[model samples]
Target: MKQIGNVYLIAAISIVGGGLFGFDISSMSAIISGDSYLCYFQQGPLNADGSCSGPHADVQGGITASMAGGSWLAALISGLLSDRFGRKKAIMIGSVIWVIGCIIVSASQDIAMLIVGRVINGFCVGICSAQVPVYISEIAPPTKRGRLVGAQQWAITWGILIMFYISYGCSYIKGPAAFRIPWALQMIPAILLFFGMMFLPESPRWLAAHDRWEECERVLILVHGKGDPDSPWVAREFREIKEWCEIERQAKAVTYLSLLSPKMINRTHIGLFTQIWSQLTGMNVMMYYITYVFTMAGLTGNTLLVSSSIQYVINVVMTVPALLYVDRIGRRPTLLVGAALMAIWLFANAGILATYGTNPGPGGVDGIPEASVSVTGAPSKAVIACSYLFVASYAPTWGPVSWIYPPELYPNHVRGKAVALATSGNWAFNFALGYFVPPAFVNIRWETYIIFGVFCVAMFFHVFFIFPETAGKPLEEVMEMFEDPNGIPYLGTPAWKTKNYYSATARMEHGEGLEKKMSMEASPERHEVVGAKEQV
Candidate 1:
């Protein structure tokens, strides 16, 4: 019980890295659409009384895309760095980077300075996003792995929720400080994450892979039980880990190139496409631009901020069910159901917008006509309802599942690299979406949700056809599922329906029943029993 308690504690702390990632996102999202932020960055003509106009669409897109571009570069390198220095150390480095970025952004005097600071923060977000899941998945027990790693997503949602409200509160302030205060507050979590990781145990699998067998044994004992180095659970787990490491040692040297080999290619594809599909779900469009979305839905001022806050509240609340039930009910069903529902809501939103959304005439700003009125009535309420529903569907499914699935696919030897590549893909796609969304809203108006709805439909099929069920299987056993020739066809099948299915931990108690039965038939005891019966 104590050992398990430690695992939860460590997970809770380490996942604050994820919280920082969420905080950066909400910090920017909450501020970018505000009038003060617009006035500060806006570069064109002033209003009749010489008041500043809001920023142009292109500028908003650039500011948002700049961070994603930095994340893209950092995510590509973070894997190699983590693989060399270790996951915990990489996370600490990322936290420090985040703090530095907060200071830079808070102190910025111009758009150039703000963009630079955001890019620096993006680098930190990329590192934490890639490493936190890998570290948590490495240490968590198989039965509890889903929720443990899923905790990262839980933290991210909490961060987003807290920052949205904080940004809302700050909106009441008089000047540029409104945004700066929220940006500065981000340092609190980053500082805590950096200091907190100092006392946590290193990933046992990573230790064993590096020939630190003694430390690995110690950690395994500490995490899996209390002071029992020779416990059956610990011994079996250690042996299997050592066996897998030896297999890698005897094979051709593991490298970034090795990820392309036939043995690993499928796993790599799964990781890469899962992230691609996740971004295609269009969750970030709502997250990063919720205020803008609400505005388009006919809300303004505090009404816009309050409506956006409700969207995030639903996001945080709905994600709880997934954290609790993903391990119990499994990954595939939650994702499939979520994807389907998301498609429904997005299309519904697009249809409502097409029917009821006003088309701006000439001299409109950011897709809204200068003469537009606040939308009231059933249609506007329906759009709000569908927007919340989209978030509710996503928070549990794609939001958390995308972060959890990739690390489970690869063996320890290449887990870091594989996850890194996948995370980079996520950021790369994120960059494109961030760059595309502001203009997409400006040019396409109500049809923007249609594009995402189509992507969601494609994602639903992609997951159903290609994604395997990894629930309840140990990391080692999950590797075998991919290695087995017969396993590929059955990848999508649930564990309960599959014949000869057993999790790695369960195998310890049950043994190899079929193999043991075959061995007993050839034994002398069986032959003598048959001879005695014939003589009698």
Candidate 2:
């Protein structure tokens, strides 16, 4: 077999993990409203006589909530597990869980069984979500890192598109087949990931951390071939790892509470808030509850389905531009533009509904009056157009960039815990919006969009004030940026000048000295791993 560049090959493995994120998300969307899923334990559709017979509403809610809750819990656990066990192992274990979950889902006999299956799938998704980005971020070169790590978002969009088509096709079929077919189909990707991962290389950063320098070197040689394994270039890599490790070892003992200590606090804050802002930006509300959103907007029947699908299709289409421009144009500017526009669109939607969304004369009695259908002073077409525009702007910027930011922000040592904390926050907020959006729309109507608008406005300020430009930098350098959070405004300064900006005394006080220690321990090991490969 022909050998490929280590960088490209690693990227492919990262994409496999990303694909699992997509598959889980897509499969759930397809099954959420399906009868077989609702009926697996007697939660079927209402009988022809319109009797209250099948699954109780509470049971259905439990099934759906269990799946989502499982993911929420998994996101929290995955971080610590990935940190301790290594990213590749976490991913492989996640893939195994994914296969198991799919099997459970396919064979589920009752509502309780189906809910349990979904929880397992959620666990898998959470694990992959936490580790995949870390693996990609660690393995990718500084120059291509943004684009490579950003592939997770691209994979998600592709999954969303595929699921949309799957649902579109399934809708044409009858009975249990519609949902069951899509759920069964997900096993293919799960199996592929299982086998694909078996052949993939481990993250070099991970190897360096575990005192396996030689493995790190061989992997680097494969990834960065045509160079001396012991060259100066390689020396820089070892130095960085050594420095990081030394710092970790000397940081006066890192406990879970230490994540909030002065040295690490900013990073913890960044990770926490990024995830918070990502969820609060209302993206999940649009993805998970768009059908209900549209239905409340006076859309119904097939039009509702098609309109919702168009939103998903737009989400899928916009990811291409997001991947292309995120690294080029940078994270802050993209999010700022998107968030500002989203706020305006949300307000406009609310305004239109408040002014003209009234259903006069008992359900409005169909096309009784064109004037009644018209939103006060606003064209219905215009309102709908603006809503779509909001989606387009969000998809290309805030949507994918949100996922890209957290993995890039934290240092390698704390990345897993930081990512876990951040993503768990994300899913928790997602659960809130998922549970609330439907009720919000029903009870408050236009006011629901207003709340989202408010959050977008808040996000605009948060991104501008705190987020760093992570594009085109090595993970080590990215972590270094956090050493002086106050210096983010001077990112364009030369490296030496930036180093000079931090007082040597302050660096030591803030645990820079400790980072140096942890990073070095792996250097000898890295050399051994690389050198051994040469001898072989």
Candidate 3:
């Protein structure tokens, strides 16, 4: 039996898929606002400054948002593909699609062509978003899984930081080709992923679920070592996979709608809402539109450029702490703690805006309000500090752990479909956030913070109540824990309202009588142990 000790390296390698995701997202922000690309429009209702105004401007905004919109559509589809195919295969396909999209975008002559390219790129990203964490989690040992999977978030942040730097660099380029270079640069990593993944192994759990026993054993030997397939160590794992696959096969006709069935409803609800709360936390809006937020905060001078760079730095730095503590501190604590801190910072920011966000020059434009908004009340120093704090909080908590949790929670057989469903939900909310933020910022910036703040508060109960603590536990054990809806240990539930964790545990402990009641959910045995040791 071969014992793999440096699981982190394996996990980190898998998370390169996430770095690709970040680079794809951040690379565009610089080019999106560049003048050379926008100047190609000959028919322009020109502003006095020679920029397009009115309808032309609206068209440009849609074109820019379409990249994100394309990604949303891609996110929805990738989830299904990742589940139906293997995670590694889905990743390989995404890389290929990404290269194709980059080619289309770099060569685009018109708005329509660019939109098509962005849509393709978005789909590639969606697949990465759903599959990278799954790959990382499956490859990692349980004790190190959280930290390793969390590295995906770190890689993503690093990608964003690289994008910010690249954007800053390209801003100085004078021609259309200059802007196109940044967009073209995205193909490099996508190409690497395509070539690199061909050498990687399929997830053993994924193989086992598919009923490829011999292949599963080979992967196990390659990854963990030749162990007694029947030893207690491997037995639990083998048993769990067989059981899960059986449950999944029995529910063979289960469509996405069947997720609403009583047998599957709790998992569905958790899957949907977890993604919702993840986005409602305002992470993407903050990332995709940081410049707009800074400008709104009235930090529009050189300060705006500096602040954007600072956010990139903060995001990267925060990932270090998250990677260090995600497994150590536990998943729920990291997220809830980050959520609470995020709420407080947001409130402080909102207050800063309210107190000092007056339109420049004391007030009115004739009879109406003028552009009197200012960020004068809060010191520049304070604003900078708060920005870092917010970024740091999000980096460690919502940023990493959210990606880590879903794959661990779902049974391997349904992981692809379920994660696809969850990530698709994420993209849907992502689209809503992107589409709605302009209006929200225009009419009620402070109110938007309040709404996000409300989501932060709700996350506390959601984490403590519904979400499981997946640190130090194998995927099989975690799924078993969540299989029973009545197994949840949280507030406002019928079980906990009347009692506590001990009482809930007691009830579960004595539920052997009810075990038979769940017989219909049990899987048929199809595995047998051969001569192998328990550990490598």
What is each predicted model's overall lDDT from 0 to 1? 0.79, 0.66, 0.66
Best by lDDT: 1
Task: Please give, for residues 183-210, the per-residue lDDT of candidate 2 as tens digits.
Answer: 7777777677767766767777888777
- lDDT, residue 20, candidate 3: 72
Question: Which prediction has the highest TM-score against the true structure?
Answer: 1
lDDT of 3 by residue, 399-426 (tens): 8887877777666666676776777787
Structural similarity to truth (TM-score) of each candidate: 0.90, 0.81, 0.82
Cα-based RMSD of candidate 1: 6.5
TM-score, candidate number 3: 0.82
Q: What residue runs in model 3 are displaced by over 4 Å at the alpha carbon?
A: 1-6, 37-61, 226-236, 246-248, 297-303, 360-372, 377-381, 483-536
Model 1: lowest-lDDT 10 consecutive positions: 527-536
Ranking by TM-score: 1, 3, 2
Please identify model 1 stretches exceeding 4 Å from their true place: 1-5, 47-51, 362-375, 486-536
User: How many clashes does each candidate structure show, in the order listed?
Assistant: 0, 30, 15
RMSD of 2: 7.3
